[model samples]
Target: MRKFTIALDAMGGDFGPHISLSASSKSLQLHPNLFITIVGDAQQITPLLKKYQLLNHNRIKFVHAPETISMEDDPVSVLRHRSQSSMLVALQLVAKGEADACVSAGNTGALMLLAKHTLKTLEGISRPALVSALPNNRGGHSYLMDLGANLQCGCDTLFNFALMGSVLCEQVEQLSAPSVSLLNVGRESNKGNDTIKQCAEMLSATEFINYIGYIEANELFDGRADVVVTDGFSGNIALKSYEGMGRVFFERLQQAINTTWYSRLLGKVLNPIIKNQLKNLHPDLYNGASLIGLRGIVVKSHGSANESASFYAIEQAIKEIQWQIPACISARLESVLAERDCLSHE
Candidate 1:
């Protein structure tokens, strides 16, 4: 296997180096060819590295960043002031070609700002988007994009998102002509505002896109479409609502299971079956969201991720490196633009 290096923002998340370092250790164990550069305050990271017995590991490198970006820190303020922050350093490593990818569990706004500033977007991409997979009724996954990157997007931006998302699903999911759908208020042609209608028209006209009709929010996880496109506002709300509902469902089930001695006995007997069936709905399984359309790979983890989830984020970065996702998206966009040019001239 070809070796790849990842720069991790160790001090970005709620648990800081404690969680990041632990996840890095687990990742290194799983991927022997993987090397990690832990970026953060050396004073804090050094002790934890020693605790994890990875202080002198050959596969590990430490880059000290004097400052850190807090979850509450404004993106613009951090871009102006926190030059030596861990998050910035990690992204810079990718920009400078010192790392194959960068992974962070930091301020969403700050990370997006720094990633865009450091790495820039692809030639045709106006803004980077956050895309992740959601479990579907077909026992597979569907890709969703703009999960809180840009709250308001124009028709052009939405069109670009569909293209980007289509390429992602085609490459990562290895599906030919993956079906693409817009998340909207209704499926009928007459429904939705002007922006949605216009974006729908664009998608439908593009021969390169396998554009299906609109998908309502209720059908998000129905597995009818391979990729679902939406503005960040609606996508973010849908994602959070799904995650929240999963948590509530499991919590309520556990409560009922523990209500009485007979219930506890029944729960014990059904534990394995329940776990097997519900594994797909666990939030930890979908912890990493790729900030696509950037020049380099950037995977964002949930700020509240535990070691398991953080490791999943690292795995996500590794997969992107192997897949060469940026290159794929760029190539696909170029072809689509060429097709558009031909159509315009005719």
Candidate 2:
């Protein structure tokens, strides 16, 4: 079995090393061939590793990073000054081939800037887009891209997102020619802004892409499209809305179930079934969003992630490393760009 090494930014996110160390310990036990490089303040991480009884584990290596990039830190400022921060150090590990991948629950903007600078984008990929799977009604997940990465994208950039997203869904979801759609105001051709309309036209003309026209926000989880592409601003808003709605829905349902004696009795019978059915939609299960199009693997975990969510982020990194996602996307882009050039000449 091939051993995989993942570098964790132990001092990123809300709970910092507490959550990361617990997740790392759990991951080490789960995957015997997995090695972890914990990057953060040695003074802080050492005691926790001892708490987790992983202080001197053979499979674990510790790298002391003196600084940390806070969630509120400016991306540009951190990029210029915090070279020795835990987040940057973890990313450097992957860039230098010291680790297979890097996982961080750090500031999204900082991670994006640092990753793009250190690892660089793959050939022909101008910028890296954040992509993650959202559970859909079809008993599977739909891939969404540009989630809070590039806030405003041009037509060509949006087109690139579609290509990247399609490749991700095809490779990771094991779908043949996964259906791709642009998130629009409506399904009609003339329903969106100039950039979206132009992107739609480009996708429609590309024979290599399985372009299926437009999909509105309400249909995001309808599972009609396997890959949904959008600008970062819109995508981020839609993602947050979906998460908020899910939380509200579950909370209201529980409250209603406890409203009456009969309801309480019925809730006992339905609680297990509802939980099993909705387990896939749990936010923690989909906590890690991949910063795709980069030369190396980097996964961004939600800042508020707990032990289970953090573990899921680490697992996501392992899967991407095994899938060789960057190489796959590069090869796909080469083919797609060649086809575009051919179409242009004619």
Best model per TM-score: 1
Tens-digit lDDT string for candidate 1 (157-230): 99999998888888887899999999988899999989999999999998878999899988988999999999
Where does model 1 exceed 4 Å of error? none
Q: What are the TM-scores, per candidate, against the unseen true structure?
A: 0.98, 0.97
Q: Predict model 1's lDDT versus the native.
A: 0.92
Count of backbone clashes, every candidate in sequence: 0, 0
- Per-residue alpha-carbon lDDT of model 2 for 71-134, expressed as tens digits? 8999999999998999999999998999999999999999999999999998888889999999
Clashing pairs in 2: none
Pairs that collide in candidate 1 are: none
lDDT, candidate 2, residue 189? 84
